[model samples]
Target: MKNRPFRERMGFALEGIRTGWRREASFRTQTMLAGCALLALLVLRPAPIWWGLVAVTCALVLALELLNSAMEAVIDLLHPGIHPSIKIAKDMLAGAVLTISAAALVVGVAMVVATGPAFLAEIGL
Candidate 1:
């Protein structure tokens, strides 16, 4: 098949995002959580470094989840029957997402705790 133009590729990506949002429960949940985190950061106005860290980490976590989901879908499509190799591939992709998420959580918590006192002072709490 001929490669799609840039615009067409973008349209395909947009469609995938819409479908994922509608069909994937995990994607929806993570999106909601990310939105809440963004709201909190906006309201609190954390330090520049902390804000950057949070934003990048959140994006990385979401991206990893999306990649893992896509990998699982492709693996299932290619191997519908139960196969140990397929199972291992899926498991490894899932593990990658889990590891990234855990790391993101730790970074987020550490940033919050490290800057909590300053944030409270800013808000006169």
Candidate 2:
């Protein structure tokens, strides 16, 4: 890849996000869920290591979603007509996203369990 200025690179990345938001429902859903997780983290004020794990896991899930979107776009462009190989490739890309998403779900649950009691008590639960 050509080394470009930071601002220019950010513009391209932002465009990708815009496209994904418009084209991929799953992307939007995952982003919303991640946002909620971050909000919970802010409320809980978890340990630094927990924050690191949440950040990394969220990033990984989002990155894999972007990759899956990119792959689907390319596959459709190259083979609009049905083919078994293309189907397999698309399925595998989706599977990768699903696997990462499942891992993120586990991390999210752990975070809630670790902090839920304190948060609930603060709310007079």
- Top-TM-score structure, candidate number: 2
**How do all models score by TM-score?**
0.87, 0.88
Top-lDDT candidate index: 2
Residue 81, candidate 1: Cα error in Å is 1.3
lDDT of 1 by residue, 1-125 (tens): 46989899999888877877887787788788778778777876778987888788788877877777888888888889999899889889878878877887887788778878888998799
Candidate 2 residue 101 C-alpha distance from true site, Å = 0.6
Whole-structure CA lDDT of model 1: 0.81
Give lDDT tens digits, candidate 2, residues 1-125. Answer: 69999999999999999999999998999999899889978988878888999999999998899989999999999899999999999999999999999999899889889888988898899
Model 2 worst lDDT run, 10 consecutive residues: 40-49
Model 2 lDDT at residue 115: 81
Name the TM-score of candidate 2. Answer: 0.88
